[model samples]
Target: MYAYGIDLGTTYSCMARADQDGNIEIIKNIEGKNITPSVVEFISPTEIVVGETAKGDAILAPDNVVLYIKRSMGKQDENREHHGQTFTPEQISAFILKKLISDAEQMTGEKVSDVVITVPAYFGFDERQATENAGKIAGLNVLGIVNEPTAAAIAYGAQQKSKEDKVVLVYDLGGGTFDVTVAEIVGDKVTVVSTEGNHTLGGKDWDAELMSYFVAQFCEKTGVTADEIYEDGDVLNELILKTEDAKKELTSKNSSSFTLSMGRGKRAKLEVTVEKFDEITRHHLMSTLELTKIALKQAATKTSSKGKSCDQFDEIIFVGGSTRMRQVKEAMKKEFGVDPQVFEPDEAVARGAALLAHFLSTDQPQQTTGLGEGQSAADERFSEVTSKSYGVEAQIGNSMMLSHVILKNDAIPCSNTETYGTLAHNQRRVNIVVYESNIMEENTELSFGKRIADGQLDLPAGLPARSPIDVTFSLDRNGMLNITAVERFNGSKCNIIVKTEGLSESEVMTLQAQTSVIKVSDGA
Candidate 1:
């Protein structure tokens, strides 16, 4: 009867739960470690391995290892063929989730069913949905998908003995994605102000920069072409593992070195100084700072009514294991005058999510009686804003335009409606194509955004042109989008829950069934 929280990260994952005393505790994996690597290895058609052991086996059997699968979530074409069977990103991710859940269940001697999973704040609809699907495939009840930064804020707010309201900025740079969020914490209630990020940016990118440098150096010393080195998957994977280790080392020491060996006695020892590492990957660090600036700007705009400036934050919090890099802290100090607080760089999200899961399952009231006056316990505890704008395609003048129905940064549990006229007489149906964009401008070119879902509303036959059709977009507290189209003339309506690019209901059920029988083991 324990509710848990999982931080299903890009390179590593962890699970946590609130104990009987209401203190959040990190649940150790079978290896007695707090975090597990998000790597999966398909050893056979019937057996799979996840975590540390799988990560180690990756260098030997590079083709069988799937790492950084978080980057491929919601991709329709990203799949691996093993033993004549196809495994999608969600399927691969399910193995990791299974490992986490199984390990937790074993250690706690209690069933772990209901859980809250954390994702990057800026993750789009498809990525979020795909994450939830992964949870379902793992045979767990996913209560909700909480944003990583928001979770961190909750953890931070809970730890504070002060009841003072504070505005906190969270910079989260994980293994495969980056997110910067600004939130206002009042006692026990956490309200997100603004969030910005790049789903493809993170610590792995830094590792890639170092790997490229290592490859170039090895080529110079061993007289081998880069393509030839890449063609040998084993050697490349070894380099990847070594490069990651070296990156972690550079975070603590001034320099780190690793030796890479290709066959035929071709071996080279490469060394990277911390300064050199920062120099090579400066752009990646700069990209995060740029996004942080955007997030701060957004926060300022949202809080301008209160006469608060972006720099007036009470504290700056850093989350994610990647934030352990020395360069990250130094950059934050140089950009903002305040010293940034690093709160459980690796475990804060899961810890906060554990607290949230407890609140959700028990419907606990707020501690300080701040915002939980009349609303449900969940609403009184947390609030978030939409990270992207949602719109429907419409014909305006001579060009097809995206008419935004919901603007970015709008508070969740919000709805908006727009009216459009039929394009042609006797139009049997009106096609509604929904689009999502990071851009905030209205009536932008359709190319500015990507299509998320589409549905059609049937109209009476022989309908004249310019008939009014109302399109409404509603976003729930969990960030799920639902669209409804109604014809004012006959009250004909079409309702669609925004379906993104991912597996269908039957597909998820099928994969769940297939995975239920497969044995998943933790790597030693």
Candidate 2:
């Protein structure tokens, strides 16, 4: 069985494998490209298109095209329908993975099955399982799911020659998501201390801002309303493409412009300067910095709790395409008092995942090109921390409130016990509704408590009021959650697997069969 590592990104995806001798090789897709844009289009019920070709068709068939489907992963209500055929986000993602795997087989000249896919560090149990379900639908055996920042840290640590272990922070701002992670590197092992991110915040927000700015400029000169232009699918799609290109251009150049053709033979040219771009998107940029600071503070708190002064990180590593923006690095420098290092923004995560694949495939120690032992190869054993708080809604007095059992930043594969008493006498049953919060702040607010799973615990009949019951939440290394509630008096317990909100076994099997019949094009 060949093991490969895949960075299933929001905007783009890449695949790579490790050779027997521990060398990492990136497999170009069928189009002979290193990266495949994460876009999918359905031309018919049986034919699906992926990558650059799908992206190109998006402007023409906006209704049938799906971009940024990754953002919709683990969502139970969101589905894409085209030509009377409905598809789940996992199903769309399966086609993307299938395309990558087909191209990988051509490059390796062998069957690829076992693979490690990387996701954002902040993904919860359901989101991670959705990714695994996509792998299953693609007929690939997912060995494990690694986090993107952890993968990048592994890749960066592989190139360093420092002997002493040091703390490092990774700021990953991709096309559709942003994540900040702090890790401690000791030899080959990279222990992730803390992570914070926004799955909906990324470069797309900047592109949208630029798009709106251009639309307003065009409206002012062409005597057309923004709504009129936006309602035109083709024109909106074209403007989106142009705005994305302009944003990329502004990354290196001080100013950029794109021409828009309005109706009635009127053409408007809209331009934006880098300063204006930064000013317009400054809040989003500051949000990333704020997350960075929070992650760092969490890391520092974790270390200080162990009687160590680890508040300062030795280095800041940048990853993902959005990190190419100048303001990102400037913000990092201003906050950290050091210039952040930019490695291969596009390939770092894939490369790191591939290295871990190599280690998992072989028993040989991971060593750098020239350095040996502690300085070169990182420790194989590492740990991860939870990114969000896990809790249940409890009825306190007259109102329902969040009762957190597992706080964020706690090391994974950990179990904690919290005791709560029965609300009334003879309470025979209790409801345990598990929720993963968007933030660690506890309250009765609407923004918190995204329910992932629930169960009913039946206690002994005729139990007295305020009966002692222990609730334990265990999070495994893969981020799979399990909740156990026990009645201390009788030792009776009920356990529920908090892995709902993703594809079920039957659903996965059905989708697997369905995807098996769909024909994906060989090239982009």
Candidate that would win on lDDT: 1
Which portions of model 1 show Cα errors greater than 4 Å?
Answer: 19-21, 304-311, 364-374, 461-464
**Clashing pairs in model 1?**
none
Query: Relative to the unseen true structure, what is the C-alpha lDDT of residue 108 in candidate 1, on a scale of 0 to 100?
Result: 91
lDDT for model 2, on a 0 to 1 scale?
0.83
TM-score to true structure, per model: 0.96, 0.92
Any idea what lDDT model 1 has?
Answer: 0.89
Candidate 1 matches the true fold with a TM-score of 0.96
